[model samples]
Target: MADTEVQFMDPLASHSVVPSGQQKQVRGEREPDRTESLQNTGQGEVEELLLSSSAVVAQAPPCGDRAACSCLGARWMERSLESMELQLQLLTSKADDLHNWVASGQDHFEREALAEAVSRFLYNCQPYFNHLEYLRSHKSQHTLLPLDSYTWLVDFSQQLCDRLEQLVLTYASYNLLCLDETKPNSVSPFCMGQSQLGPLRVAAFRYFKPMPYLAQVHTGLYKRMRWNVARLREEQREEGKNERVGDTEYYFLCYEDIPNADAGGDGNAVRTWSIGKWVQVTPGTDDIYDWIMCEVPQADYRRLLFLGSDEPSSSSATVRLQQMLSSHQTAE
Candidate 1:
């Protein structure tokens, strides 16, 4: 495939195309605009809030005794909670704005604006997760930290995941629309299977350039949250706790062509959509960051569809077969 250029124009400047392959080389040129966007949107506000919260935690009355330490921890928890609530309010407003923009009729320029908005929101969410992880790590020190705070954090993380999923679906929908708009009348190699292309395939083709970057950002956020949740689950299991602390599930839509399950003479490839759930099998190992998407059962897929969900599920048999084939590939 030919290289695609993703260009974002400043309202004050002329049109310029930034080649995706050469983005790093042109980073300096793009930095100014990104910095400007951050400033306009109050980008570092979350980090500032978190820093102030940490300051409060640090300035807690000297822990000269057990009672004093406990009191200090209680103060820290209260300050952290207050800071998190304020950060959540800020993020929720940004999320709402992004949703409104997506709902409205957007042209190319508006689409760029949407992408910028998403990038900014994701940037803010990163620090929020980091702060949450920090708090989790120090849970032992802060005896006053309520169990309910952990639950609230998990729910809030899932809420952010929901928003990211919506963004993915919106981009995929636009990709499909772009494909239709750019389709050719001639039956060339590039156009042969255009109509049959799924959202994943369309995204792979970079039909809409921002789709790939945004999808990647979405994946990174999901992986970080999943990793944290996996650790929580492991701790619960080790302690023999029946009540699960953070039970969060994330899935991505996938499409594949597979042979018919029915007994037939000429087996043909049938196009199907499937949901692949993201799993972090090794939380503390060298591969801790290596997350995989395992195909879910057909029943779950049907249930999701019945519930009016945008993502479709995958065929487990097909996915397994693909994995087996992949395992045998020779290393370069």
Candidate 2:
């Protein structure tokens, strides 16, 4: 038998498309406007009627009894309800995406802009995590002590809970880089009282550059900490200081395991680290604030410790994540 060749439809057009299958629009479906022309017109516009040969609007068949009409009406209502439900579901999905976008700083702020600039990010989901708060922010050295620790503790907690929700920074899993003060920024550095501006007050300021490399985390189980020199601010409070020092001297927040750990490196999974001032340039203004160790805070460790201990305690292998950008907070 002679071989006959049949040309196949183009694959891009005929073979590949969504749903792995395609059906042409139902051929009998009447064009709305065109059908409007041929079907009926009760109004004023001058127009022509056009009708599709294959499509003729179907009318309800004549019914002899009232029961048939009622049944038909009910079926119509049910179909309309189903269609409305589908529309509502689509709208709901769009609304949810919008809400998440707003939380991610996408609605009012550009995504790249938000990522580039550092500011306080507030998360409403605070109650779920222990010692974490909604008011989380990236702080600078110009910030003071009390605010730094309080905010960092809370911010660290929020980030921990959001480990699963960090939509942007995806590579570093289960790793957090908290700001440790190689040299702590302190109030005492500017020892002189407010003098020049009405009294002997020194002006203070802080600066921070974007740190992308810090995101390269090595392990997934815990957070490791590193510190740089802490810079002092320019302002000198009215509060007098005992010593005279430069405005930007670096102070240190000394840390060891909390509850005083044994000399050996191996210890419990969740550990508490104590923070203390390495050096105190105390005058009217104290230079050093309380220390923050990589070890989990005392109260928070208790909280995480409570979780896996349902049966009056067995053991746990996970440690709480803690880290923050160095920010100088006001004494208050």
Poorest lDDT segment (10 consecutive residues) of candidate 2: 46-55
Best-matching candidate per lDDT: 1
TM-score of each: 0.43, 0.19
Residue 58 accuracy (lDDT) in model 2: 22
- Lowest-sum lDDT 10-residue window in model 1: 187-196
- For residue 54, what is the lDDT in candidate 1? 61
Candidate 1: segments with Cα more than 4 A from true spot? 1-44, 60-64, 176-332
For candidate 2, what is the total of clashing residue pairs?
A: 33
